[model samples]
Every structure is written in structure tokens, then in C-alpha cells.
Target: MSVLLSACGDDGGKGNATNTPTTNNNNTTDDETSSGGSEGNTSTGGPGGTTTNPTSTTTPGDPTETTEGESTTDGSFITPPDGGGGAKECDQWTQDCPEGQKCMPYSGDGDNAWESLKCTPVMENAGQVGDPCTVEGSGVSGIDNCDKGNMCWDVTEGVGTCVALCVGSPDAPDCAQPMTSCLISNDGVLTLCLPSCDPLLQDCPGNNLCIPNPQNPDAFLCVLDASGEEGQEFDACEYINACDKGFTCANPEIAAECDPMAIGCCIAFCDMTEAGVCTGQNAECLAWYEMGQAPPGFENVGVCGIPQ
Candidate 1:
């Protein structure tokens, strides 16, 4: 009997729950993908792989100045509509702001005004390539967050910088600026900009490596190579790479009678062809492809598991 294993996939966004595994023969659809950092501004896969509407490119005004009935970081004066109650402040969700400002909604965390909308200054320059950005936070970094046509990639440790969105052909990629490489995510859903690098020679700057694109295997992107000790089986892990190379962060259902974690646990990789590769007495080596639709390059991958 063959066992199936379910794992997480990278969606260029915050990690979602692990997909449940199913039993079937060849052509089984495994919805599992790899896990990574927080979500980006891009849309999920649609019919014909079409992306949703891109972020707005409208520039915000000087973040320093404060407008009447608008919220700001600086200490300023602005009485509510009529001393206390007249016209409500702007509604970011409804885009209800004064003519000169944009509705910058509150993120509800870390010093942000929860459930409140503020009329922020509309600057002429926003969403430029290489500008610093944050997915969820007050714009205190001086750099305007993603405005339009740009997204904050690799959102980890509570920060994700800006990167221009790449559209069009995968073979003939067109990034916002020249010299930027169009890199695809592991789940083959998103394509964003990264500095070009040579994988064969491993000449990427710092600790980054040129890894093959999961969607388009022919293309490569500069990423951090797996290093350090591998996480042991059943250890808590944040993302796929958080576990040592050759191991995967998998759903706890893979283990017989084991409780699942909100994040996931590190599972040892196994070869289905060989018998008893999984060290767990109750665990079996299950082909990832047999469970569901494995990512493009993960069809042959297997994980230690117990039949679900």
C-alpha cells in the first residue's frame, strides 16, 4: 500500500494551513505547496494564470505635514468636524479622504490606530523600484510602502521591502527596471524582481545563491542557500527552508496518531522505492505526487508518513 503526504506551498504570502492528504493512483491532485514568509500584494492563480488588479501607483504627499481632520504621527492641531462631532474622519475602506490626501487605513497593530482611517498626504513619488516597504505597519520608515505595480517580497521578521511586479512572458521577462531579474515563487504563482545572479558559478552577492525557478526551471533567482544543521523530525519550523535541506515541513497528519500543529513540523525526506526508509516505526515513506498535485519540480519527492 502506498502512503501520501501533504505539505505546505509557498504563495509569496503568510503561510496558510497545510492541505489534507488523499489516496489515489497516478494523476492524483496534491494541493500541497511549500511554506514561506508573509503574503505579497499579488493575486493568486486565476483562469489562464491571470493576476488580479495590481496595487495603485498613486503617490502620497509629504508624510510630515498634517491636515485638518486627518491623522498624523507629528503633534498637530485639528479639531473634529464641529468641535466634537460634525463630519466623520476619512474612511480608508471607502476611499473617503480630502482632495489632497489619500485614505491610509489603519493596520490595527503596533502603534497603528485600529479600525480608524487617516487622510495621509499624497506625494508625487510612490512605489518606485528599490523603495523600502512594509506589508502591514505605519509608514514610519520614510519610504512609502507598495503603492501600485509593486509588492513587498520575502516578508519575514516583520519586514518586507519593495519589489516591482513582473508581467508578460517568462522567457522574455520585463521587470520595472533593467538589470532586475524576474524571479518566480516555489508554488509557480508569483513572479517578482530580484537582482540577477549566476547559479552555475554561485556568484550572487553575500550569502545568496542562484537557485532555479520553481515555476520556470530554466530561469534562476538569487536566494539564500540552505545552511546550518537540519531540523529534526517533528521539530517546529516556520517555513520549508527552516528545516534543514532534504527535509520538509509537513502536516502532522502524516504521522499516525500525532496531533497537528498550527504551523507544522519538520519531517524527514524518504525514498519510496526503498522499503523502510522512514525511521519512525509507524511511519512510511509516501510519495508526495501520489497524495495530490505536487509543485512543478516536486513530483518525485517523498516524505515519511503514516497512511491517512
Candidate 2:
């Protein structure tokens, strides 16, 4: 015999009651990539084993794998042979460069590494002095260099800025400038320069996601969910808890479930539309306690049985 108590009842007092999670509520801001890694202004992946559109890189988060349509975070690219690394031409693939020119591997040899690589050169207006680069290889923090025609320029300037290249520089008008709105390939890496830290900054490349800041809308904190992979769903109780005090997530769905730990956990609501109070959807229901429900013998509720 088990008894079930619903948290919806008087159990929710004024003071001690847990606050609902606060969702990001800031208006969309301009796009901005982080400086390095996921925190940096870019999302990365390893070789996918196949050829991809050079001009376009990856949509933030989604990486490439061995199969087409598959993604990986290995940071590998599938570039043509003559471009360097031969068949693995895309070893250093970036959004910069002409359509077919992207996916070229790093060519310059020296301690200069990513900064001196010919495939993607340090732009004239990097904003930051000296070379802006991370690791110089495919396994760790570096990216692949596309063909000579294309170049994924660094807009952020720092070591880990979102790099976007222009195909046939003379042809594309936006590519000529340092900071400008440009088209990113649906299947390649995407980067942007956001004005603020709003969650909208996560949408720069279009495929990445952002976690809301309970403290302030101005702070768009970066989440490391699936930077170089597909979007994955997680259990509600797994992470998010209630949002900060004083503020509650307007959407009960998110507040009810979002885990405090996991990156992407949404709230689930009970579907009172029918009979049983256990009708919540998504992962939010994991922590729900129905109201106005009575237990039979500390075993089960009058109507709503134990949550499945």
C-alpha cells in the first residue's frame, strides 16, 4: 500500500514553496558566437567521411558523421584530395571560402598553427591584434581549412570566434566586410556576432540552442548540449529545477519539468482534460504531484493511480 500526495494542494505555501523556473524572456538580439569551444563563438565536429558543400559549414551544434545526413563532433571534414589531406580535404572545414573551395585542410607548417594556415588566413580586420586561433589540429580545438578560393574569416577576433567565409569574394557583397549578415549553408558550420547575451544569440547559425538566464535576460548563458551533434531530448527531472526566486516561468510546461542539471529538459503538464490527473506531457511530469487526490490505503489514489 502506498499513499500519494499532490504538491498542487496546500503543500505549496507562500514562502517555502519552490519557485517555478524562469525561462529566457529577452527579445531576440543580434547573433554572437562565443570565444572558444562551446563557450567560444563556434560549434565544431570531426570528419564525416563524405564530401559536403564547402561554401557552407555546419549549423551550430549539428556535426557530420560517416554517413550523409549523419553528424559528428569529431571535428573532421570531408575535403577533396588536392586540397590537402587528399580525400580528407575537409579536415579544416570552415564556412569561409567559395562554394567548392571549403573543406580544404591546413597547409601552412610551423608553430604558427591555425593562425598561419594558408587555407584560412587571419583577416585584416580581425579587431584583435595578432593571430586569433585555438588548437592547430582536427582532433582538439582547431577547424578544417577549405579551398584557396573560400575563406572562413574570424568575426569575433579572439581565439575561438565564429568563422564564416565568402565564396568568390569579388562576387559576394556581404563577405567583403568584417561584420555583416550572410547566408550560411544548411549543412555546414554557422557563426554570428551577437550584440548581447540573449538566448537568441544561440540561434546565430540556426541549429544551435540557448539556455535561458533566470537572473537576467541580458545574460544568455551558453549550454553545452549537442554542439557537434543532433538535438537530443532528456528527462525533465534529470536537470532543471524551479527558476530563480521572484520570477516564475510563465509556461507551466517548462517550469514543471526543466531539470537544473541537464541542458534541454522541458516541463510536462498533467492532462486534466480527461479523467486521471496524471496527464502531463513531456518530461515535466516527472516531478508533478496532483491536487485534490485521495489515497486508497497508502497504496493508490482514488482515481489517478501511481504515475506510470
State each model's CA lDDT, in order: 0.33, 0.21
> What total of clashing residue pairs does each candidate reach?
21, 68
Candidate 2, superposed: residue stretches over 4 Å from native: 1-71, 74-135, 139-203, 213-217, 221-264, 267-308
TM-score of each: 0.37, 0.24
- Give model 1's TM-score versus the native structure: 0.37
Off by over 4 Å in 1: 1-106, 111-147, 153-160, 164-231, 236-249, 256-263, 269-277, 291-296
Model 2: weakest 10-residue lDDT segment is: 1-10
lDDT of 2 at 102: 32
Q: Where's the lowest-lDDT run of ten residues in candidate 1?
A: 55-64
**Candidate 1 lDDT, 125-202, residue by residue in tens:** 554566654543322211235654454433332344566656555345566576566643211222356666433244
CA lDDT, candidate 1, residue 308: 54
